[model samples]
Target: MPAEEGSGIHCRLDELLADRGMTLTELSRRVGVSLVNLSVLKNDRAKAIRFSTLTAVCEVLGCEVGDLLTVARRP
Candidate 1:
């Protein structure tokens, strides 16, 4: 299903993973996040993210929080 319009924050996980030549499965293993959860974030279906999970992902991807997430404005 498509993400709801202006419903949640945008996650750049797919782009960052591609730029680093990493797959979602690889990231899931490295960051200790479940593939399903990661997929949710990757597809912009997540309503919230834990700080620890965010930190782990950022550490593995060599990116800051801003690099992984962005605010999507409602029209």
Candidate 2:
């Protein structure tokens, strides 16, 4: 489903990964998630993510959930 009409869902995963000089493949390797699966999340194509997966990604990337995603009023 599309993001809610006014939820303003957005993602910063790619930007943060770039800032850390980490590539998708690298993140996949470290986080034990498939590159294809990570791509889904990175590209905002994923409908949902397991809490364990999210936690593992955060641990590997040294980031919080808030750093990877954001919700704001849709302009």
Candidate 3:
């Protein structure tokens, strides 16, 4: 079924980082993003993400956009 409108959009950054044995600090440094910004994205508190930011993250993490983000269906 299609996810309902307003359903939560989640980030899998923590899981991806864990799988790669990488830390947020390391990723922040590699992606040239601030820890605060990465933390917001990792915690799914970010309302939007730039394509450049996404591309940088994907390059460092060896993942696609879909691997980093997901939508959680409303219960």
Candidate with best TM-score: 3
lDDT of 2: 0.80
> How big is the positional error of residue 26 in model 3, measured in Å on the Cα after superposition?
0.2
State the number of backbone clashes in model 2: 0
Q: Which lDDT value does model 3 have at 73?
A: 55
What is candidate 3's lDDT per residue for 1-75, written digit by digit as tens? 224324378789999999999999999999999999999889777878999999999999999999999886566
Write model 1 residue lDDT over 1-75, tens digit each, in one string. 223645657889999999999999999999999999999999988877899999999999999999999876655
Q: Number of the top candidate by lDDT?
A: 1
lDDT: which is higher, 1 or 2?
Answer: 1
Give the alpha carbon lDDT tens digit for every residue of 1-75 in model 2: 126633355667799899999999998998899999988777666777899998999898888999987774443
- Give candidate 3 regions above 4 Å deviation: 1-7
The local distance difference test score of each candidate is 0.90, 0.80, 0.89
Query: Sorted by TM-score, highest first, which candidate order results?
Result: 3, 1, 2
The number of clashing residue pairs in each candidate reads 0, 0, 0
